[model samples]
Target: MKIATYNVNGVNGRLPVLLRWLEEEQPDIVCLQELKAAQDNFPEGAIRNLGYDVVWHGQKSWNGVALLSRVGKIHETRRGLPNDPDPSQSRYLEAAVNGVLIACLYLPNGNPRPGPKFDYKLVWFDTLIDHAATLAASGAPVVLAGDFNVMPAERDVYKPQRWVDDALFAPEVRAAFFRLLDQGWTDALRTIHPDETIYTFFDYFRNAFARNAGLRIDHFLLSPALKDRLVDAQVDRQVRGWEKTSDHAPVWIVLADR
Candidate 1:
């Protein structure tokens, strides 16, 4: 099965690009982030028409997430990060597609460092780390895929120096990211192509994509048990060039059945 993750930015604004990508790539499962729409405005029928069974968690304006499965039932669905007491945003969603536990996340963008927003971002990462630990202990094959809003390492960003003060590249944020990986989940893309220069997101206003000045913020993390079945992993950078597309492109991985 092929599983993909995309931060579409806004479902309504980028519907055309999304439809085109779905038609061309045809992934079996897709986890979407940043829908930026309300539940009523999800364009459900339009997506279902494409032959996908959709499960969505939507809020107004800012954040939202969804999962599209072609051949599996969503056995369970969860919205918001676990233990998030005041989840005013729809930043995380979990669903069991087929037999695999899939998580779609749009981690907070803690821009303008040394601020409350940045502190919230750090707290969010910690919460995720705790949750990831719980999930990992289950020994079930899980795939955490989405826009983590984190750059794992210096190599993951185009100009490390330029992003020094950004929350995504902050030392603590990167450490938390690594700690999650250390919990036995595999960074599928990096594991397969460690030295390759790859990225999934760019700044739309700066011609970042054209210059290959982008960051690898989106990811497909697999549990250790799925390592052998890991077949292919890649970043669909081409999708970012589409009209009205998100700053992020689709990142995907193929897996063999258990």
Candidate 2:
């Protein structure tokens, strides 16, 4: 089945581009981040008309997450990161679709490092790592996919040095991402294409997308049980340059039928 992750930037503003993508890609399941809308503003009817079921956790003008499944009932497992000390941002949501556990997350883009925002980013990562441990223990085929807001390695970014002070590439952030993989989840895109020359996001500024200057912050991580079934993986870079497009693009992974 095809599973895809996309950060639409804003659900209302990008409805046309998003719906077109859904109709074209036709993924069995989709995990969306950065809906940037309130629960009541989520364009439910528009998506429902596309023949998919959705479960979303939304906030006003910032972070949000959603799961759309065409194969089974979208079972919401959790809304925000449970047990978090602070309760401010709506950045995570978990659900089960088509017998696979899925998580849609919009990890904080902690800019201006050495500050509270960056600290929160690290704390959030810890929370997600804890959640990953629980999912691993369940022995289910888990697919944690979304805009992690992390550049896994220097190669994942255009100029690593330029973003050195940014939270996305901060040493602490990279370590947290590695910790998740150490917990037994395979980085699907990196796994199938281990060459280390792929990207999933680009800054709208500085003609990043036009020049193909991008970062691979978006990801699809799979459980080891689903590793061998990995068939295809790619970043749909073309979507990033479309009219009224988001800074991020779609990342997709296809798995063999069990």
Candidate 3:
């Protein structure tokens, strides 16, 4: 099975681009972030028309997450992080699709730090870490995929020094990410392509994409149960070249069947 994660930016405005990609790649399961639509505004029909049954948690004009599956029924497990610091934002959604538990999230950007937003980001991340430990202990196959908004290491960012003051590259945030991995979740892309300079997002400013200046913030963390099943992982960078596309391109992993 092939599972993919993409931060669409805006589900409504990017519907065309999304449809085109879905038609072309046809991943068995997809996790979407930054829907930027209200619950009633989600393009449910549009997504379903492509044969994907979807479950989403949406908040108007901001963070949102969804899971789409065509290979199996999506049994929704939860919406929003348990005890999220800011539950008002629809940032987390979880479901069991094709027997694998998938957690999709749109972590806060926490820009312009030294403020409440940044503080909340840390709190929210800690909550996720706590919950992830439980999921890891369960020993069920799980995939945590989404736009984490953090560059976990120097290799994951284009210019490490330039982003040192930024929230995404903050030392505390990067350490938290490593803490999650300590629970036995494998970073799929890094594990498969170990030393390769892989990236999933590029800003529209300064011709970032054209210059190949990007950040590998979006990720897929696979639980121990599915570690050996991982066959391949990659970023569909070409998708970012599409007209009016999201800063993030689709990232996917192929898995061996049971």
Candidate 4:
């Protein structure tokens, strides 16, 4: 099975680029973040025309998440965290597809440290940690994939020192991410390509893509029951260079059949 995650930034604005990539990759399942569209604004027809089934949770002009599965039916499991600090924000969507519990999330950017937004980020992280524990304990084949908005390790950032003060790299945030991993979820990409300097996002400014100044913020965390099936993981790195494309790239993982 092949599953992928991408932060499209805006669903309608990036429909062309999205459809193009979907055509090229044809992953069995896709978890999309940052739709930036209202519930009624999702480009369902465009995607359905491509022969995929989609379920989305949207909020106008802000965070949103969606799931696409071409392999089989998508049984929606949840739309947000058990105690999401900010339920008003459409940040999470979960479903059962092809026998795996898939979670699509878009963590807060939480810019400008030492402020409410930053505090909210931490609280939200704790909520996610709490919810993840239940999923981890369930021992189901679960895969949490999305733009987590944190660089968990120094190696995940292009220039670690420069971002130390940034919310995404704040020590507290990284620790929260590790706390979730401690529940037995494997970081698929890092586990497969550990010493490689791989990245999935680049700033649109300063020619970041051309210079390869990027960050690995998007991720796929596989539950203990699913980790052993991990066979391959990859980032569609060049997609970030495409015209009018999202700063983030698509990431995918291949798994052995159950």
Candidate 5:
């Protein structure tokens, strides 16, 4: 099965671009982040017309997440990340599709570091780490995919030194990501293309996309049970160049049938 993750930026504004990609790629499963629309604003009918079953958690003008399945029913499991007290953001959604547990997440973009936003980002990562450990121990075929908003290592970014003060590349943030991986989840893309400098997001400023200056922030983490099933992984970098497109592109993976 082909599974993909994309940060659409705003689902309503970029629905056309999303539709075009869906038609072209035809992935069996898709996880979308940054809908930036309210629940009522989600174009459910339009997506359903494409033969996909979707479950989404949406918020107004901010974070949101959704899971789409073409091969089977998407049995929603949860709408928000566990352990988040008074969680108001729609940043996480989980579902069971085709016997696999899929967690779609839009981690916080803690810009302008050394502040409350950055602190929140770290706290959120802690919650995710705690939850991921439990999921990994469950021994289920699980895929935790989405825009993590983190550059795992210096190699994952275009200029490591330049982003030293940036929250996305901060040592603490990177450490949190590693802590999650330590729970026995395999980074699918890095696993497949170990030495390659693959990237999924490019800044709109400074002609970053044109210059191939990007960061590999979107990811698919496969649990141990599904690690061997990972067949291929790639970033649809060209999609970033489309008109009125999102700053991020799609990152996808293929898994062999069990």
Candidate 6:
């Protein structure tokens, strides 16, 4: 099975770009972030026409998440992170497709750090860590995939010093990411190509893509049950060069059939 994750930025505005990629890639399952549209505006029919059954959680002009399956029904497991005292944003969506539990998330960017947004990012990371621990213990095949928004290590960023003051590269955020990995979830791309300088996102400014000034923020964390099945993991870097494409390109993993 092939599973992919992409942050579309705005599904409605980028429908054409998204459709073209989907048609070309044909992944069995896809996790999408940043729909930037309300539930009613999800354009379900258009996606359905492409032979995908999708489940999505959407909010207007902001964060959203969705899971699309081309081979089978998507049995929605949850819409948002559990126990969120003030649940408002649509940043998470979980579903079961082809017996694999997929948790798609669009983590807070926490920009202009040392502020409420940064604090919330940490709190949100805590919630995810707690829940992910339980999922790791369940022994079921699970994939935590999406735009994590945090650069886990110096190697994951283009110029580590340049982003020292940024929340994505902050020490605290990186520690939280490591804590998640401690729960036995394998970082799919890193596990497959540890020394490679691979990246999934590039800023539109300063010709970042042309210079290969990118970061590996989008990720896929695989549970132990799925680790051995992982055959390959990669980023579709060329997608970032496409016209009107999202800053993020698709990151994917291929697994052997059970």
For all candidates in order, the CA lDDT equals: 0.90, 0.88, 0.94, 0.94, 0.94, 0.94
Count: clashes, candidate 6: 0
TM-score of 5: 0.99
Q: What is the lDDT of residue 24 in candidate 5?
A: 97
Q: Tell me how candidate 3 scores on lDDT.
A: 0.94
**lDDT winner between candidates 2 and 4:** 4
Model 1, residue pairs in steric clash: none
Off by over 4 Å in 3: none
RMSD score of candidate 1 (Å): 1.0
lDDT of 1 at 198: 93
Q: Least lDDT summed over 10 consecutive residues: which range in candidate 1?
A: 77-86
Estimated TM-score per prediction? 0.98, 0.97, 0.99, 0.99, 0.99, 0.99
**Error at 7, model 1, angstroms:** 0.5
List residue ranges in candidate 5 displaced over 4 A. Answer: none
How many Å off is the CA of 157 in candidate 5? 0.6
Relative to the true structure, candidate 2 has a C-alpha RMSD (angstroms) of 1.0
Backbone clashes for every candidate come to 0, 0, 0, 0, 0, 0
Can you write out model 6's per-residue Cα lDDT over 1-258, one digit (the tens) per residue? 999999999999999999999999999999999999998999899899999999999999999999999989999998888886347999889988998999999999988799999999999999999999999999999999999999998889998999999999999999999999999999999999999999999999999999999999999999999999999999989899999999999999998987
Sequence-dependent TM-score of model 4:
0.99
Error of 5 at 257 (Å): 0.7
Give lDDT tens digits, candidate 1, residues 71-152.
Answer: 7777655778788734988888898888899988888899879898899999998998889898888888889999999999
Give candidate 3's error at residue 144 in angstroms: 0.4
Off by over 4 Å in 1: none
Error of 3 at 154 (Å): 0.7
Q: What is candidate 4's lDDT per residue for 13-95, written digit by digit as tens?
A: 99999999999999999999999999999999999999999999999999999999899989999999997888999999999
